[model samples]
Target: MLMLLAAGLLADPVPVYVIAGQSNAEGYGVPHAQLETIDDVTVVWPGRAQKEVGPLQAGWGANEKMIGPEYGFGQAMQRHHQSPVVLLKTAWGGKDVWCDFRSPSAGDFNWAEQQMKTREEREGRSRKVGAFFNAMVDNIEVGLHQAQVHLGRDDLELKGLVWFQGWNDYCQWPVEEAGSPCGRGIIERYPHNLKHMLCDLREALNDTTLPIVIGELGVHGSDVPKSRSGWALRAFRTAQSETASQLDHCCLAPTASFWDTQATDHWECHYNGSAKSYLRIGRTFALHLLALDALPDGQTLKWQASQKGLQAMLRRYPPKSGGLALWGSSIFRLWERAPAHFSEFEVTNVSFGGARSWETLHYADETLFPIQPSTIFYYCGSNDVNAGADAASIAERFRLFSELTRDRLPHTKIFFGAINRSPEKKERWAVVNEANQLVGSYCETQDGRTFVDLNQVLEADDGSTRQDMFLPDQLHLTERAYEGFARVMREALEQKVQSP
Candidate 1:
């Protein structure tokens, strides 16, 4: 019995693909009369039947009478891999990324407070932010356990994720009606929200390089009508494609070509409940997953577009020598009026959104060499902390970055900006504090190096992250917070300049 158990443990793990999202992912497809079952593929759809593991076939969609893309995805995967596969599905109808499917990294939906309060008052139920996201995680866990049992091996691996969502976000009320904090609708922030969802999902699943295949929001098909809604659909589809393009190990499966005008069960958003569309989309998604291995390394491809954009921005506004340079992630990149704050110095911002420490090092040659700035105010590591890097590792990356900067510009003074604490990252505060301490200690070792505690001004009197200072997302800072940061940084710079 012991030897048999060991053999079972050593057996090759079954590859499981998690298929999740909103209505489209849940599948409104009318089941085919004669559905073929892929015996090689097992499906654990907790959303439909609790922990019931079965063969891949019809009745796995929203109900027993429907079919989802997983049907075709499993078919294609089985045909290509010629091995046992698991389709672990968790999906819900009418979900939106802005709130329902919001990821942890995306932070709270503060702008929806009034709406939530009203709903709670009326329905006596409060819709918490990231509700669906948490549910998805829990459901995936349940599915994974069932998969392990079905495969008779504890080593079952979740190989990929297929996401098909976006209609609700695209249908968000206009700025005038919603009156959001940033004056932006869900559609406007859809790309950023979607990216965070994917990244945070990966982190939660402990598979940072897991392949993701997104079904582009091609509901209206190729011949999009000329109207307000049509234009919005085009924009939304473009945003979906753009978001997929930025992330590594992720690809978009085009669905517009598969859109059938004659296959209407009801609403157009569900691709008219077309079995052909869902099946084709699933097959296309499988093809993309197969080809994902050929893509560039995650580290190299991550934020490649933002890195290239930074280079382009620098070319357009060439940085002059003997000036100040601001380096970091989206926090610094989004500060458009940074130059206005540093009036005494020619401030050039080379920061980019979603940048990690390694990216900073990756583009050092292009960002630092040309400028040779007299001073650089650095604000990074928040992303690194979120990416699960240890404090020591973050500090080491900073040291390496400083060394590279000092090598070319020896006289340059580098100031390390303290990573700010926020309500969103409250759980990870300990890690953030440790990273700040490690980086601060390293800065104290050098004469020209300094550690600026920008977080001080951004915090409330109670020492908690000031809710008002942060944007509705609860991660990025508001203009008031940036102003405080500018004031503190300016004072710090002046004091450092005057020191013997």
Candidate 2:
């Protein structure tokens, strides 16, 4: 591994990608079954700027598999840009979107363990999540360190963050409310308290500009729960896009029909996904990360360490020991603007993989709100491509996304992730590409936003989309695809664009 410092202090910014959120992002993937050698090209993350890498390492492992979303995007990017790509995996196989993994150090684990054991006994099974609880924090803390060590940078040095959650939420969300405050032990806050977690995380990392890409979670079904499906999962998956839209530096990848199965060593009951979908999801988010760093003119939200925005907001609360400020979540530490003062922003992603325009639009309205972000980077219409949807439908989707952007943000960037082509019998690649062209063309009529034709840029010289560019099933691009996608955004941002 070429060290970052010795490789020459990144003349520009290091193309760092954070792989966060639940299982899919953290990797419940099955390692490839065979020991067949592909090539370094398949293994390398994007941004390396060179191809013809040697025979690749054996990705297949007994306890695990390596075919996940980031694989391709990372390879393509490294080859394309000569930039080092650091993927920090911070996924907890089964956790809720709102649950912030709490540490034992944060509270008394004995009480938590006792209560947990009591419940397990009542249910005639041992429900000790203590291992999972500790592992979650350990994974993130270690993953953050991995990024730091690999990227060789402080706070603002890393590039972007990718989030793939929802499955965990799908399994637990229904019952979460029943278990209030998690028995008052150390509690991982919920999405309802998302601001606390996000704001605090930003403060801790000191990277307000960190682009966060959250993959919409879909419960295609998992071994964890037989009933972890149906309306609850469907509705949550539909709504997850909103969570992504609301947050800055965050984008949502459609996971509606993206997963396939293989075996894994992580959870005894969970099977690894096709890994290609994971690869595509990773790439989807990476594209936005690259875009955030690439855009030259985008304004960034700055962090305030000293009491500037919080003091005013806190004064409304009752003063106990020090002041009302002390009572509020400490994340207010760097929150410069009061909630009232913070700009009301909006974002709507205009594309989908397997989802419909109406379904996506509906979820956008319901799930996305109180969004921290102003503009949405929409990438959709893939699944629809095979469904006989025309360019008009694609155009309509973009239009709907734009309108939703207007309603929520009132003032924000509404960039579109160019919906690319799919060759499945159901999806006519040519027509889908044309629809993307239409969406790009139509977006010109909108304001504070632009359409990025990442698909055009992602194509190989041969005119055929790189096979390694997508999953074996061929619905989406692999990790390299996301890397390629991100590079396009990087190139654009390097030139100039609007930002939050």
Candidate 3:
């Protein structure tokens, strides 16, 4: 191992991937001997010791007899990047997110602990909630330090995290007893708890946009009777999926489909101890990470130019104290050409083409919130639906965006533009409509937020987009479409101005 380190083949700033979860994450599969021979890959199996590093191998599991997803994950990453790869594996079997790895920011688990009747009962389960989180953080720091010393470089980058644990939170506790001290009712709280965990982890690591890939729970082929736990697992899975969709630089890897009964240790939830299953999940995670990493680091050239223009406009004719801002994707980008009638009020176009709700949320602090617009005409979600996001995920992310904006700019009123139909993305029209309904419903419940219906004018009598109003792509708008959108937005803002 020392000789390998001496080879100095790794590039400066080695890419480090952290894999954390419970038993499944701990790897129940039998180790493949060939994994230990992989070149340019370092495995930090903390379960093996406080500071253990070597070529990838098995024995990273809690039992020290099995391998987990890290084996395959490391291999996949190594294959993709020319630079050396480091696998930091930190997980324990039978650990729950509500208690074992619960983040401090998620709030105290005292309510859940108080449910225990006796001091002895409480004491028995009194381990800190973020115990594993602390361990993982420590391991990452130490791993980086050791790598810097041994690898002879200071450019080690903590690239991403892979999360696979949720069974404990969903199965061990009864969903029926959620909100009670006896159980954290983690099912209902899973999404929020998971979100808090992600936020706190990023803060601790000092990378707000660090990419994270969450693996869905359970082995699809397991004979474990889901007759009782099936609904609970589905609920937990939904929470995980929705959380990923709602956050930027986060994605979900469907691992249940990779479950192999032939290799699983326990058929119920753990992927059969099959090395193939773990390998597939790991590769899937790596692929998703690679895809996210491929996205442009900033807005496209055209959008950047548009942003500069908007800035110039703000400088020339500053909004009347708190003015109006139009925000969203391509539809709103073209709306930048709205009729001069919009100039009657202070208006700035902040839209970026192909922007998703998560992307909007990610840059809100810099782009939307700081401007402190009195009124925001928001149009987003079609791109997300086009990207395969479900209606629930789109709605959930938009909710987060709206809430964050409202929190930062309390006086600002928001008008959510219903997504316009696109003939090119016809298959996703249902999802778009559902997302619009969700957004409209949420706006209806808020005090300063209103839903602006663009479909009335943008949609044809047949319920498809108006052919003449769209560009050749059928996704973007023509001058006629922008005219219609501008008219609707102006009317909505006027109504808000006149009310009371």
Provide the TM-score for each candidate, comma-separated.
0.56, 0.44, 0.56
Q: What is the per-residue lDDT of model 3 for residues 111-210, given as tens digits with 9 covering 90 to 100? A: 4443432332545745655788788777777767766665565667888998889877777555223345343355667777788888888999999989
**Model 3 residue 463 distance off true place after TM-score fit, in angstroms:** 40
Error of 1 at 215 (Å): 1.3
Q: Give the TM-score of candidate 3.
A: 0.56
Q: Sort all candidates by TM-score, best to worst.
A: 1, 3, 2
lDDT of 2 by residue, 113-186 (tens): 34544654778974343344345435545555554544455442455656555554445433422364233222
- For candidate 3, list the clashing residue pairs, or say none: 13-155, 13-156, 27-68, 263-272, 263-273, 263-274, 264-272, 264-273, 265-273
> How far is each candidate from the true structure, as Cα RMSD in Å?
18.5, 19.6, 17.1
> In every candidate, how many clashes are there?
0, 58, 9
Residue 167 CA displacement from its true place in model 1, Å? 1.4
Residue runs of model 3 more than 4 Å from their true location after superposition: 1-12, 31-36, 63-65, 110-123, 175-184, 220-226, 264-267, 300-500
List, residue by residue over 1-500, the lDDT tens digit for candidate 1.
58757977776767889889988888878855678888899988775653367998888877777777888889877875678889888888888887788887876555443453454467676566788999999999998988877666777778899998888777753333334433234566778889999999999999999999888887878788998777778878878877887787787766787787889675788888888888877876776565453232343436766666877877888877899988888888888888999888998888878777776765565555567789998888888877777777677677767755654466899888898787778788898899899888888888789999988978877886777899888899888988998998888888997999
Report the CA-based lDDT of candidate 1 relative to the real structure: 0.78
Candidate 1: where is the Cα deviation over 4 Å?
A: 1-11, 47-51, 108-125, 173-175, 178-184, 295-500
